[model samples]
Target: MLIGDVARRSGVSARMLRHYDALGLVRPTGRSHAGYREYSSKDIQRIFHIESLRSLGLSLREVRRALEDPSFTPAELVADLIRQTRERIAAETELLTRLRRIDAVEPSGWEDVFQIVALLQALGSKSAGKRQSAALSSVDDVPLPVEALVEAALSESDPNVAGALRWALAQSGEESLALLAEGLGSPAAEVRARAVQSIAEMPNDGATTLLREALTTPDLVVRRHAALALGVRGVADAVPTLIDMVVEGTNDVDAADALSALATRPASAKRIATKLADRLAEDGVEPPARRRLTQALADIPGPTASKALTDLSHDEDREVALTATYILGLRAAR
Candidate 1:
């Protein structure tokens, strides 16, 4: 077959066939009597082989080596091609995400687009100062996309930068709540904690609702953050987890403070006192934990708290009884 016929049948363009021939990649094996390049059956098979290899992302040079070099091994080359393809896909995906974020900004002009891109790049910068500055400036003239803020908040390791990111996200209002909630489900404990912390800063009812839901998560850290946030919002449902935080001695001080805040409400004071007293009475409650629980009761008012302290005042442990006596004395002095 002539070059034209091969091009027609194989779907390879005439120009590309000539380029292949010029590169000595798929030269025809014979010449027609009319002094034209002609392809033998073996040459046609070689062209198909070249096309097949090219489809797998092989460069022309690699294709030639694959077809002609006896020492060439395809295993390593194939693995390299797989790696390159994966890299290309990742690059494309990142570019697409960037474009989507830019579009989400609803830029009014090219200058606005440039500014948004600059801020986004800064958010991902290696310098913590740059990231924090970017986060602080994000709520400027053009607000950064909430998604970008959430992503930064979840991954940030620097405490200051993370706080700025969380602040920026909170400014975005309830829209940031969904992404932050999704972060709560992340397998990384740090990410989940960040999500809960960020949610805690959002004062909207949506955030409060999500925090209430987070109270039941399997992660103890997540639950503690949620409970503290909820307790501050006067959500009585958080009382149990806040009490648990005290018992486990995880952020127990903050937990106690939250409980005291919740106890200010008349209806919650007795219930909070009862839970604390029960934990105090549990078998093997330990001396230190008992002391901590006893101290926790000092802030709670109402007869429930007063009577519990009165009962603890006569307890067997000297420190416990003394601590309770000191608290009751302070209450009496009031």
Candidate 2:
């Protein structure tokens, strides 16, 4: 076919097609009698593959390398692409987090803030993680000061303050975990919720029991945190209980946490996904729930989970539409 035909079919401009040819990214299958380039169906397939990789965040150079070598497996190329995309996402998340902290700082103390800003500028040349760690370490270790900060964090109604405290505590390791768990037993519901999250980060028997007990706590926030903690733990034992909570419970927060936790166990996740698909077939489950279940299936990595998610992606529900797309991307990466 002519360049126009390839451009129309591939949604890539004619100029790009010629540029790709120049870069040897995609060459014609043959040449016409008049020496014009002739692209066959196979060429179009290559174009489509390139387009897909580009959409997934691969640069032209990276895509060209993958295409040049026939020995390069699709799985390997997709894995590299996914790794790059994840790194980009992590960097962007960290930048956004820093911006949020900067925005929260008061503007009244201009002189001191400006001096600190200049110092930060010098430190910013280092890695973000390193800079953050250095800044935290520079603070005085007086117990009263730390306690006051913790108290302020606990009393503050803002989620952002809670999140910042969580992040800071997470970086402190065991001490942070101990502090958060202690906070959970405090009078403030917000403090308890934050503590539950910190407990979830601790992958020990003590943390597990704490989470389990929190599930039965009187406070809704505590119960919700327990469910979240269980999910993050990815413990197989929690799966059945979470499933029961989903099926028999009326609390949306609990149900959401159960679903999140259920998605972490590979074995139980597959079982639950299959059960959800069966329920969908029977027309007994709600569309939103079915879609959430489908997404949960996709989130659990492995061939069995991928196959289940792929099947559910074709479900009539629009909510599950992206689940299939994500599952396919993961499968491709695998």
Q: In order, what lDDT does every prediction score?
A: 0.92, 0.62
The 10-residue segment of model 2 with minimum total lDDT is 140-149
lDDT of 1 by residue, 1-334 (tens): 9999999999999999999999999888889999888999898898899999999999999999988888788887888999999999999999998899999989999998999999999999999999999999998998788888999999999999999998888789888888888999999999999999999999999999999999999998899999999888999999989888888788889999999999987778999999999999999888888998999999998899999999999999999999999999999999
Q: Write the per-residue lDDT of candidate 2 for residues 281-323, one digit (tens) a residue.
A: 5656666666555654555555566666677667677667676
Residue 275, candidate 1: Cα error in Å is 1.4
Model 2 bad stretches (over 4 Å): 1-150, 171-188, 201-209, 218-220, 237-269, 272-284, 302-334
Candidate 1 segments whose C-alpha is farther than 4 A from its true place: none
Reference-based lDDT, residue 96, model 2: 72
Q: What's the TM-score of each model vs. the native? A: 0.97, 0.40
What's the residue-level lDDT of 282 in candidate 2?
60
Q: Could you tell me the lDDT of residue 62 within candidate 1?
A: 93
